[model samples]
Target: MRPIWVWLKGPLPAVPWPHSESRPDVDLTPEHVVVVGASLAGLRAVEAARRLGFPGRLTLVGDEEHLPYDRPPLSKEYLGDLPGVAPMLATAEDLRELDVELLLGAPAEALDLTARSLLIGGESVAYDRLLIATGATPRRLPGSEGLSGVCTLRGLSDAIRIRAAFDAGARVVVIGAGFIGSELASSARARGLDVTIVEALTTPLVRAVGAGAGAALSALHERNGTELLCGVGVEGLEQQRGAVTGVRLADGRLLPADLVIVGIGVVPATGWLAGSGLELENGIVVDETLRATADVWAAGDVARWMSPDFETLLRLEHWTNAAEMGAHAMKNLLDPEAAEPYRHIPYFWSDWYGHRIQFAGVPTGEPEVVTGSWTSDEFAALYHDGDRVVGALTLDRRGDIMKYRAMIGRRTSRREALAFAASRRQPIVAAAG
Candidate 1:
């Protein structure tokens, strides 16, 4: 078998070998490994465990009746004119080959850490090892419950319903200008529907990418013929005959709409985990190795684990982070004695107005445009906290963003980042638009 090298903080160990194949030097395999949440992360965890030669019983439990499916496209292509079935992460045959038991439809009701069991559908399932990857649920608009033409996109069923509204040529009002909301607005406009975005912040994505970059990104809406209302709060939903008719603004204006997509945010799915004796802050508080407690682990959006590299706690809700965390957490679970800290630089990409926007690392300090001009709509910006490059954002510079991502991981200095940008042979703008 090919050797797997583990990266440590300092110099490499003398005997460099696959940690999974070499560590512990004793049997640590569990009889039954039960994973809660059959989404991307949970599924990946099961696959990873089997690949690491754990010939044990594995079970995947999910609240949704359908098998695990990809979610990124739910707000993009899935809502477009030619909507296709939600893409599955694993097929029935795939799971069969993995030799795993599957439980669908019933959500995990509670977790009994002391008893080492999970309660699902009024039944207790015992397990020697447990992994929680329950993911998250979308936050809803206040007073919009039970109203027709109101929706929040989080799953396949939500996408199918929203797609029907778009097909009917509904005038859409998207609340919040975050990634999900922005993507929904983009798809609405692509379908030739009148779209308007309402953002409470003065600038959209200000919290995620800072003011200047957020403003630059918000401009894409206007350029694509969509109206973007910023610095405005939603008072409530205007309804007629139990159907949403418009959104009343705090400033005494009502934006007429036939459909309203609430993309405010999502909270971690921890209600079922209440009193589970696990530390639950914004998410399930896990250590650097994603261990919540002895014999228990958490991953994906539900996990708020410490980042050894950044020296802080982070809970990421992105496709790449979820997929990576699943495999890492499982490997760590299998080899508890030799578990390693998960040092990852957050990365995500989005499609808007025919432009692919990608960002890596945590956005900190002022953004310095290093390549191309914002006017050209092809640029890369570096973010620095003191002398260390902490983050990078790019608009239509796909090939160059990963280079900056690597730099962020290495904690590249500002001078070094600038020099690398200069080597690109492209004019570097001094300020981001």
Candidate 2:
């Protein structure tokens, strides 16, 4: 509840709130660009639009009061001992610099996309270029401990509550062993707090990283002393006086904890765009250019564009890809410069325990693994698609991974690409080296 200082790109004194637009607000005009969902991608999109000489009125609407801050820190720096320097993506004053009209604490209830306006609370704001950056919300479980301490780590408020609980020396029980869940467990363990991660899946991060990477991540968590419980479902939550005390697993087990962090996954916040005529699958279905059919564009966690390598239209939740896609959307909005199809190979890095883990590209289907080592612990295994590097797992290898990502773009044969494993140097952190 306290407005802690978030360092951001510069030294930002902490002020609070939280962006996106998928539905094009055609009624908007310098005149106006109403950006829904004041989130990472939303703020970035706002900045990019203004930077690219968007001579228009800008209004940023969101459901939360917290300003544009980085979500990744909720698991790493913010949750850990690192303080007074947490990097918030954008600050309130930053909005002033961009001349962006701020509408905070107002939940956008409905989207009149046809009328090019948003019915927020009671007011209707008409816009021209609407960017639906409504990011995903935490998937809440029914009858599960809806307690004061039972929380999720997605937005700023969620992180603040969890941090306060951790600071108070609460033993945290994290349900679901996905990315956010695993990262939360790592941070809690790093703080020397008792932490247990419960997952119904056989392997943690099975959906996100697949089995191979999940195994490595599990090992990392084990090394950090985080309890990883898999293939167990949560039947219900133990509550007393409306406060969660613990969770009951489907296996007839009760794990005791004062604080519970549920990071099951996120559902795309495309509910406002419902019946808006813009295709909304898992996310807003955008073409290669990050455009969702009409003049409306989509990016970040909410905007699911086509995956060129997969040869299928897919929504990506990776931070790197989201940022890149936002940039691409901005470029296209200004004046698209790409000749061929606009494709960005997905990449993500998680700082857990003592390792800054990074994964590049999608590893959905059967991928032939090239090279890796668990003990010495420094390697990069390229995932080959018929002799072409479709995906790669990088352990401590930073620089070469960039080149490997470029190789995926060349459409090279998988066999020829993986042949250089022995000759190449191992994975290195981009910052360290």
Candidate 3:
């Protein structure tokens, strides 16, 4: 059937359709829509499809038994003593209202694109359309398996165990000084636990927001009484009677710890899609429209798609990107012919020792502090590539971060960004070389 494409009203920037000839013969009105991975992206896809008046038999599949819950809080708020309640993405009644067949604890085993079926827990489910949002799995430390007191914060269960350890006054050693690792250290310090962070790079988050900003932000750890060890590699985990006791550094240093949190990073959860005829690189390779194959669409951390704005392929593991990409992928799935290219300006925020660190766009170089100095707690900096303002970083400047985000989206020049920052009446610092 000829698909009926409905163009939603919005002020989205138009870009050239790069996959006009590769557009799939999709059934806009499918009989069944199956979404794999019931996390944020998958849940949002299900919700968006139902909200858009899709009257198909909808199924949401998840490996975890629990319903979709907020993951960002797992490393921060949920790990604290006052974890109010589980940050559930949807309630039972909400799912019932949407007529969703929720399949929990049954992970998708494999995909049969030829038969248009999914194998899950020894059962085959047929579908006319599919959305893969399996997300990513936390990378584990080699030779540390089967050891107690070693944990990675990816879900609720992990958070609960870590919180229990914190309550018991465990000495914490966090590996990798990324967002999750940094937040874990912050929470550990807040609980009055002895905490130390070990990062392999010369400066934590140097790859994300450039060396200058990363070094500046890493200072928050030292300011909060947490030991920050950079440029050190972990040899292995020291174990005592099948429980982790400390981290053994490659430089013959043993950092004692009762609990170890590994926040290194995550790998795309595309193992099940291996040999499934799907293009897989570091993740499930999708086009600008988030399409994998003829009728299969991928989103969230599992899908790496082309970014029309940057004219490159991006695979973001942030919550904002997952949530936004989920909804966008659903819209494109519903209206294939008029599918809009996802041109998201990546944004992420991290809380460390009562400081809110927010960054927007892609960091191309060392940030130029346009307003406020690096010594001060409250400041806004702009990152530029030549003349174009490619990114912005702020510490506790919550009110002004969005302005820079918009500036990055509009491809605003560095001069204009600096002028905008100067208009705030704050003393402007000289631009970085």
Candidate 4:
């Protein structure tokens, strides 16, 4: 049986069929550039290809029928107060003016690395250049398919479902305390609904933003009447007649829920490229230049690029990171040898319960930490690797964080930073960095 979503396949106005796929007759010169994914990274990639003077066929392939739009609002503004904000790609009327074809809703069914062509919908689309901006999918518990009232928020439909559940005041149980989960909980609370957030980790956001930030976030959720179950693991989901009713913890606790939000985080949406010969550990592994392998590049939350300093692959789902990485990936796709390497002080911003929090740099493996607060709602917490500052987290006071982000551009000393924190205006310190 054909899926109900098959009607979702087609090309939009300027967003025509994604060219630059592995098709014959496409010039190797700057004549054809195909970009996959129509959302944040894919959209930006097309623009970058244009900027690189690629004066030829531009094709964009996306998995979603809806043109690219913002995801940050899904859990906050879109669900809480605002109603008319829908997902949309950037106003590329300029690209429309340039005759770039956009292929919407048809995902790459298979990737032929040897052929350098993607068999999208069983048709071989050739390309002089290709950009894989596939993006990420929500990480969910195993065996969750066909569970009614259970969903993960990563795309338009997910947001629509979760948002509908919130408006209905469904008894919501969210798994994971990561950024997405926290935002969902806070948004649900704002709508005056019963929401419970279940976290498997000890501290929320500590894995990504560190402990102090996590503690503050937990406190905020508690103060706002959201129940947070820490140190709890969801072993399995309970269903009554194929409909989700509750969540079962590994410790033998049954958490009843009319609706459950799983924010366990996201996995790179790279499953389509299984045999594409790309080095994919968890995602499409790319280099510093955002180049995956020969004639291939990836970006956004799906691309796991090697970190400059750290010996690890960093796949940040931050908004700023997505924009930065997408731009860089596009540049490389045009001219692999002439493109600049990708490196940005990773930053993420989230708003919840009237608090605007911003963070820069990856807060990982901190031995000792020093924090500074401000009279204004702006303050920065510094994460340290021994005596060197590696990461910083900020709250309401974003300007100070802006400055700190600039200061810690390459690296900084912990002692000097701590001095600034101690003698400064609003100082708040938590020794656990």
- Best candidate (score: lDDT): 1
lDDT of 2: 0.72
Runs of candidate 2 with Cα error greater than 4 angstroms are 1-30, 84-86, 334-341, 366-369, 374-376, 425-433
lDDT of 3 by residue, 1-433 (tens): 1111111222212333234334546445777888898899998998888777676678888888887898998888877768547789887767777778877776788899999999888788899889999999999999888899998988888988998999899999999999999999999898899999999999888888878788888988888999999998999888889999889999999999899999899999999988999999999999999998889999999999999877788899889999999999988887777788888998999998889999888888688887777777678888887888888899988878899999888989988898888886343333331
Decoy 4 TM-score against native: 0.86
lDDT of 2 by residue, 1-433 (tens): 2112222232322322111133243222235666777777777787777666565567777677777777787788888787624457776667767777777777777766678777776777787656777778889877764468888777777787888888899988999887778788888888899989998888777666667667766787777788888899999888888888888999999999899888888899888778878888898888777776445677788887766776877776777766666656765654433313458777888777767777777775544445555443666666665656777777677766777777777776675676666556343333226
TM-score of each prediction: 0.92, 0.86, 0.91, 0.86
Q: What is the per-residue lDDT of model 4 for residues 46-161, given as tens digits with 9 covering 90 to 100?
A: 77666655566788887676656887887788887667467565645544644567666667887887777877766787876678888788877787887889998878888888
Ranking by lDDT: 1, 3, 4, 2
Candidate 3 residue 38 C-alpha distance from true site, Å: 0.6
Candidate 1 Cα deviation (angstroms), residue 40: 1.0
List where candidate 4 sits over 4 angstroms from the true fold. Answer: 1-28, 91-95, 309-312, 367-369, 372-379, 422-433
- For residue 144, give model 1's deviation from the true position in Å: 1.2
Per-candidate Cα lDDT values, in order, are 0.87, 0.72, 0.85, 0.74
lDDT at 191, model 2: 87
Please state every model's RMSD to the true fold in angstroms: 7.3, 6.7, 7.1, 5.6
Q: After superposition, how far is residue 407 of candidate 1 from its true place, in Å?
A: 0.9
Tens digits of lDDT, candidate 1, 134-175: 999999998998999999998888888899999999999999
Clash numbers, per candidate: 0, 35, 0, 20
lDDT of 3 at 182: 94
Which candidate has the highest TM-score of all? Answer: 1
Error of 4 at 290 (Å): 1.5
